[model samples]
Target: MASGKYLSILALTGLITTASFAQKSDADYGWVLDSSKRSVKNMPQQNEFLNNQYPYPSKPRSMWELGVSGGGSFIFSDIDPKFGFGGGLSLRKSLGHIFSVRGSYNGSINKGADYRLRNTYDGINGPWNGNYLIYGNKYVANYRTKVHQLSVDFIASLNTPSIYRGNPKTNIYLLAGYSILGADVDVDAVGSNGQPYNYTGINFEGKRSDIKSALKDKWDGEYESNGSIRNESRDAIGRSDKNWLIRHGLDLGAGIAFRVTDRVNIGIEQKFTMPFDDNLDAVKIGSANDFISATQFRLNFNIGNSSKNVLPLWWLNPNNYVYNEVNTPKHMKIPTPVLPDADGDGVTDQFDMEPNTPAGAAVDSHGTSRDTDGDGVPDYKDKEPLTARDCFPVDADGVGKCPEPPCCTELREKMMAKPACAITSLPSVQFKTGSLSLSATAKAVLNSVAQQMNANPECKVKLTGYYKGSDKRSMQLGWDRVNTVIKYLVEQQGIGEGRLIFSLSDGGDPNTVDLMGTTEEGPNSIPAPFPNLQKSK
Candidate 1:
């Protein structure tokens, strides 16, 4: 029995060790990442990693456990006490992290003999030369008994939540339940071969050294009580009637388990069972019933639904939830922020080169105020971006003076010799109502006029401005448009002012027109055709 028990323990140890290694290997490759390889700010939250794809209390399903245990069982009774061997098998199911249930079948076999009665019993006193026949024979009887029990227990976990970290390593629990026991007891006289058993060369000091060899040859040279005498005692205690011998009992147990993996655990347990009868050993002399106790080593293997994600609820620590919740931020519904643009430019502050550019300024793609001619002046402040290089020392408007060329004498002689020619009409330059600013279409028209003037360099062009109103503001606005066109020509196209003439009509066309020709034949100042149309102020 000891050898068999040792082998069973070795087998269970080997299985648990193998499973533990596999569990460790899986954990090494799981979701845990190395902190050295990434910054905390960039790493996923620990709780998020642990609770991935599953929420608390609704985690993946787990398996049940099938277990076997073997160890020593002893009966507390009026008869001489003896050590016995007990073994059991159980099926356990966990309801949650804190509770579970198990059903089990256990059996124990025990043998007991009375050395004092065997030495004193005589034929006159029930076959041992004693005076009291019935009691003496009863005391001398040796008995072998077998007990089978079935029980169901509700178990409560005590330390699972505290022990389970990423992987559970241990669990401790308490259990209590109901049990039913069936027992059979057989007894006979000490000597079956017509001779009293000899105790010579035998050690009766709680040792079984040669006892296995002695009991090997059947019942020869062994102490035994008369079968009839033992049967009478059994019948008195109702053990002979199977229908009256079954017993109900209560059992309480406690155990501690060391987890080998998610799928295996090794445990040690002690359970006490009390039957409601005193005939377990066929001896009814005692006032109290017998107490049966077993202390065993348990090997439990989880079975069915072998998902790695499925762990026993007792193996899950509630601290995991607390850790995740405390460490993770709650998601809030809020509007996205608008990017800052301090200068009100189209470019945001982060990419803007001139974050504080003045309002109404024409800015470039970089948010810097425009400097079209690279003249060191912003378009907002520079009246003439195309100022000539020789005109550097000028006013704040960036207008540069045009120096006269040294060929004045020859140009005067050529002009005096040239004859008059017919002028050609040019397209009108339109303007917005009461405004002097040039539109893109007006600038394009001015470009064409500049090309024509360049082709006919000897010609002087006449520009005539008109407006619907004779008011001073209207007159001033028309004059400003004419001057703006002249400035554009001189600064942008390098056209000389002497080659241009200007006039105004009160209400002729409400637009500026140009004609190019020689001195006398070119368009002179034109009179207004609708004099009455002008606003009189």
Candidate 2:
């Protein structure tokens, strides 16, 4: 019983040792970095290196894990033969993309109470020799009794992809290691005889009582033939002497690991150990004590999913990145041209000004648009390209191309006669300095003018255009200034072109300053002082 208890303690110790090694190995390599070989100095730096040429995360890191399991054992010995059952625990650590190491401890206690023993002695058959003495008696002895044994083991296993527990979903592994074995046994008799005997005694009081009792009970008076002194002396050998022994042995196991999640794995393993020393059984016939072997089936759980990425030893070698069929190194250099059409736009760098146009779109000479005004944008994109006649042909000036003196003079007289008909009173159709866009204040006034135009369809007006310019661009600038106002009246206000008129001049006419001409900013500069349309009139 004492020896069996010690074996259980040793098994528990082995389990702790296994967990210790796993934790140590995990701590040693968990945050390990190989900065000595990683560098940015030799590779393309800053603007010289293209963005895609740089490396990013190759793979996400895997975590570490632990597991445990249990099962039974079959004990064989001459003193007792029985089946005992037990359980154990294990720990494992993953080393990057290649390798992993594991340790585990397991043991069992068998109380082999219902056991049997068989003994058969080959009769010493030979021609009677001078030295050989022949006796005419037959002897047979067997012991049926209770025994206890404990087995403990420590194991280390290697995992591989090509082997077991290597593939992603599930893997298998082979394990081998050493263990300590211990046991305790109580016996009934010694030698090939039915009588109980003891090997030695202290000669103290009450020591020979077991032998005296055995002789009086099961011996049936045959004990006197073997002699009372032999019984008394041999009875000392099997009685009350403490004998506990320990031995180390080899252990082997096989298991399958399955990933339950990204960070955890569950495994089932079966293992057995063969003790090198025979003290494990302690009660065998003759001089040999039979060793012990335990078989256990366990459910193992790994914490960090180490088995998911069991790495190969030579993974860091650049040559390992080779392709077999192509017979070429995957990382070997091959010239790759820098593509010009990065955005996949049809436009090339040289000819296409807007080379990076959207992938599927029509472009102009400058890769912009065919229609600068974009009244309908263009025929390619305009759903209502021909919806409005004003979109097709635009009259630069609101006045008709042919202006007869009688008709023009008549219209001008009527415009000046109205009290609210002055150019300023038509709401401020202001223009930007050196631009045709109307300002916020100008837009407000223009909106009012549009409202008035919508109310009075019969009203007619002439927009006399002028520019504060003293250069070759004076006429062009003045024309654009007048054109802007005319477009607003006709296009925006829905005023008929025939109802509006425009006065175009190369520059502000000095002699006709008292006429209906208006002053504005210079073509290439800002206006000095605002021109008063009243004074000009």
The alpha-carbon RMSD values of the candidates against the true structure, listed in the order shown, are: 23.6, 20.9
Residue 507 lDDT (model 2): 50
Question: What Cα-based lDDT does every candidate model obtain?
Answer: 0.60, 0.39
Tens digits of lDDT, candidate 2, 1-537? 335743774575456435533321111121112222223442333212224354221232334355556555555444344446666666655443444555655556542321221222223221111112222222222222222333333333333222211134444455666666443333333333633332233232343444334432442322111100111223111113443334466667655554444444555555556654332332234655444444444454434334333232211221122222135423334588553544333333554455555543444323432332345453235433222343354333221223336758876555435333222233235454556565544543444445444434444555655655654344455555566666665677676666555665545541221112122312322242233321210
Instruction: Please tell me which predicted candidate would have the highest lDDT against the true structure.
Output: 1
The top-ranked prediction according to TM-score is 1
Candidate 2 has an lDDT of 0.39
TM-score of each: 0.45, 0.33
Candidate 1, residue 19: Cα displacement in angstroms equals 19
TM-score of model 1 (CA atoms): 0.45
Q: RMSD of model 2, in Å?
A: 20.9
Q: How many backbone clashes does candidate 1 have?
A: 16
Native-to-model Cα distance after best TM-score fit, residue 460 in candidate 2, in Å: 39
